[model samples]
Target chain A: MSKKRLPNIIAVTLMFAMILLAGCAAQPSGDLEVFSWWTAGGEAEGLEAMLEVFAEQYPDIVVINATVAGGAGVDARAVLATRMQGGDPPGSFQVHAGHELIDTYVVADQMESITFLYEEEGWLDVYPPDLIEILSYDGEIWSVPVNIHRANVLWYNAGVFTEQGLTPPTTMDDFFAVAEVLEDGGIIPLSLGESWTVVHLFETVLLGSMGPDAYSGLWNGSTDWGSSQVTQALENFDRMLDYVNEDFAALSWDQATQLVIDGTAAMNIMGDWAEGYFKAQGWTPGIEFGWVASPGSSGAFDALSDSFGLPKDAPNRDAAIAWLRVCGSKEGQDAFNPIKGSIPAHTGGNRGLYDQYLQSAMDDFASDAIVPSLMHGAAASPSWQQDIIDAVALFLGGRDVSAFQAALVAAAGDAGY
Target chain B: MRINRDRLIAFLMILPSLVAIAVFVYGFIGWTARSSVSAWEGLLPDYTFTGLTNFIDLFNTPRFQIDIRNTAIFTVLFISTCLILGLVLAVLLDQRIRGEALFRNIYLFPMAISFIVTGVVWRWLLNPATSLERLSGLNLLFHQAGLDFLISKWYTHPSFGIVAIVIPATWQMSGFTMALYLAGIRSIPEELREAARVDGANELVIYRHIVMPMLKAITLSAVIILGHTSLKIFDLVMAITQEGGQGYSADVPALNMWYTTFRALRFGEGAAIAIVILLTVAVLIVPYLVYTFRSEVEA
Candidate 1:
């Protein structure tokens, strides 16, 4: 109340304000921040549904559904990285299962090894071994995958295919033959989207050309990127590029799928997420559209799983564990994946919950050999992945297959593969 | 004694901003400079001095090289087009034509919109899709107008994609440049123009000889403003042609820096890019500051 003490009060208040503004402020008790990029229709609803399960399990805890909206975690990952760098990580955050989770967080020492969670919950037996493999680094499990998305689905307009009396292409030769017929018939043979989707298509082409083993070999030291097989794959991607819509650069992945839906394009190489886009547009899976494994990639599942992990020093550690458990549990994944339009990461998920398309995906995911997706951050480090994206973007303009292959070789060398 | 007290009060009033700028501006800049030279990567900081390794590596990278080239093209085209277009619009408005305020608002409306919106709107207006089914923008207009030869791939053109970016940049900034030039033109004495007309100078000659030359300062300011924005463009490029068009044909250094630092967690390289951009802008601005200060002192 005294005039002389007023300056002291002001100075003390300023210091407190600065501290609060600098993110040292504590969170409210029982509050948890679950971070993700699932801001779109079904995926967002899917996340909400899983959170409802978590809510039922832990009614006392409050969940903050933090989201950053971008396709393929483009903007979200960057925001998450900065937040972690600032030492203000969310309680649990969505991350891709493999090299993305390892190289960005685990290797950087920002993530806790949730291997204990796996042990405590008996997840070691329930989750698929390959999914466990991708989630592990340095003998430690880093995250729990919620859903598995097949990244190599070749969805075609069934009407277009039937009109041409053609089955969906199952081999490289079949693809080109189908493409020629479609292109000659004035339909864009393949609908492609922007740069990242192009990278996605290129990944499937590589898998299709080389099969799962050789394609998987590209990421490890086993396969040579400059090998004749990769060269053939690059050539295939180049020729496929010629068959894509001329305005491919201007369209997003959904827009590309729309091209197939409207019958402007005959086929599209996209992830299973396109199935969600198709259904959202009122096109039924078996009726309006048909899907096959991308050419020559049959019996191989090119997989990318959207997983959630606990960061070190998370504010709500107990709540985060609860959240992770929900992410990995059979009850939660079945709730989430049915709405998310993807199959469950937990093999014990309810089979009847998924629809016609995801059931087939689940079958393929069970029987087929699994290879990691390059574009979705499983096969390579983010840096190396960016290099390939840039290389693909460049190759798109130039159509120089050898140059693209050389760039891939260089990128692999840089990644120390 | 009273005057000295007043001066002290003024200094005290400014002290907070001065100290804030010293810490937040120059201090952070210094911090960035230090971080750029560190061997940091992957969401963690390592200040082990790495010399010029980041800069050298960036220079050697093909993407960075393409970025520098794109920046060069963007800066030159953006500044030149903004200046010329701004000057022309200003001159046309100076004719005291009908609905001058209306035309002025129309020219300046794009400035009211952010670069993101401008980029988005222009993205639709200048779409490069050559296929009829996909062509709905400027290309479609060109087709309808029987100007098919003028229908370019715009930003999708491999070598000249950044040039297409200039159209949007100019669309957004030329209004600002026009306002500046219009102010410059209006500030020139009406009597001088009247005297020139009395001395038998034609309208074109009066503008070229008197009004245009007097806009030299405005031109310099416009160039610096437009040049720097073009140098470190991010949001506009992000909105339009995010994959850098095709093959990063429209990619700028700012976009690359963003991806490197935030996406790839190459903080050192990203900071190096930020510093490079700052230095390039400083190159454009430092001399202008010196000249303006010297002129103020002379005055």
Candidate 2:
């Protein structure tokens, strides 16, 4: 009888073993799901490079790449919110500079403090002091800075510049002069993308055109829309719109850059990420593509930095922190920013390690007084930025400066900015 | 009394659908209504009741007003065009035409693709450069005729925004209505067609008097389905026009709600928009649904 009962015991033991195995398998070791919006043309390759290095450092940590592609942060943030609200937050996610998070991240205390990481990495001494200041809230670090993207760079085709017998425009007047020359030469003057982000290019020009103090004043509410500086900036932005592609409203960013790459358009006002696109197309930067400061900014740069934040209640909190460390590390920066085609946020990040255009960007970033871009949802309320988009759209579509300014004033009032 | 086991099984079978409605449908509505009354941001809902504040702000928004007007115009035009075109195709296909299977499948296939996919493909087709380039490549015929105007930056033009919204919607939904009409036509008894023919009625007369009247039930069903879909239209408008709110012309209430909740991080206001849109759709659809249910009971 005891022998017959042995088979039953064996079956029960097998079932228990299976359950134990399943439970063990469900327990992940240092697995982190990283969320970001860098899933387009060249950004994808850059992200892959960063992940490759990350994998090399912590071979046990599994990194899940969750990227949503929309021109702006809209698509990525939307997906992240839905997930977080559904109680499945990613270990880390990308957020921009300024108060974009106050409404959600700060209120919920969902952001984890990365003070120790920043301090331990000695990033306090390396990255720009202003960047460190922006990342601070209530005297604690809440995110890891990844890369500094200068949004005001004007990229032009070298062949087009040569054919037109022109140099990269250094001032508003020069930009228009070159644009006129290019148009006369039967080349498209500017390759504006179809999204609302073209408003970013316009704002970059406006920021530089208004000068740093006046530009910062626009964000800090120190300057009124009635100011002559703002009025002139708006006028120039409107005039510049005339050179944009007729189909600018519907062209994607890559397509806009393609016109430059194909030598159809003379220049494109875009972020450094355009370098990634050019490189992906088998075109070497500084050879097929070139960069210049936004017109009116001789050396001033408009920059937006991308950073990663760990939500407070991340399941694998330690793992998430480790990933943030990797993101801010010199090795990680070298591996990531080259493909990101952005300047590294890591202090003493190896500039010699990057491609030529990015290296040049690093030089400019070092030499220039970088100003905040309003389009990055920094320095102003989202409502204010939204209003600016509306104001810009109306202005670009032929609204008078007075009406556009009124719209801005009204929006500022509405957003309590 | 004898137990009706079949009725019990039928109720059991319908239980999953009823739960789905309760959870996804009713649950979301209640949650959204509660959220609308509270100040919420990001993933967090602030339970503080700022009474009528969000609604007042939403009403004052010019973008919201434009979105409402665009939605209404789109709903009316989209429904009418889809019905008219669907009926034409249904009538023509019902005539025992050659390659009826092929034609039927061709008309029915658009229904199979999801709105997301439909929007993606249509976006490319409507892109001005892409369309013009493709058209010009067609032996200079289109280029000579200046057909470039047909493409005219359809997604961005305020005047053509509704047309842009309609094309993809009509592409996807017309197939559904066509199938309904086809089913209605097929359901007609053979004797009815024979009787019409024997009465010396021409094809148009037979269709107008006999076939069309027979299709009233199917047409009403089609209208109700399409009407509800039109009221809740989001994806096509979002895709064709970059969510339209960015430009201030293409903003639908759903897109507005999304922007408020996620982009703007004003969850209370976003939830308020959601509730308002929910009520609007409910007002349009609930009565029709009740009527349909009553008719089904009578039948």
TM-score of chain B of each: 0.97, 0.87
DockQ of each model vs. true complex: 0.47, 0.21
Candidate 2 fnat reads: 0.35
Clashes of 1: 1
Q: In candidate 1, list every pair of residues with a backbone clash.
A: A393-B247
Encode model 2's per-residue lDDT on B157-268: one tens digit a residue. Answer: 6444555677789878898888888888889898998998998988889888988998888877787788778777777766766646225555578876766666777778
Output the chain A TM-score of model 1: 0.91
Q: List ranges where model 2 is wrong by over 4 Å.
A: A1-73, A82-91, A101-103, A313-319, A381-384, A390-400, B4-17, B130-141, B144-151, B188-200, B245-248, B297-299
RMSD of each: 11.3, 11.2
lDDT value, candidate 1, whole model: 0.89
Per-residue lDDT over A100-154 for candidate 2, one digit per residue giving the tens place of the 0 to 100 score: 5543575567776778887877888877766665676788877787888888888
For lDDT, the strongest prediction is 1
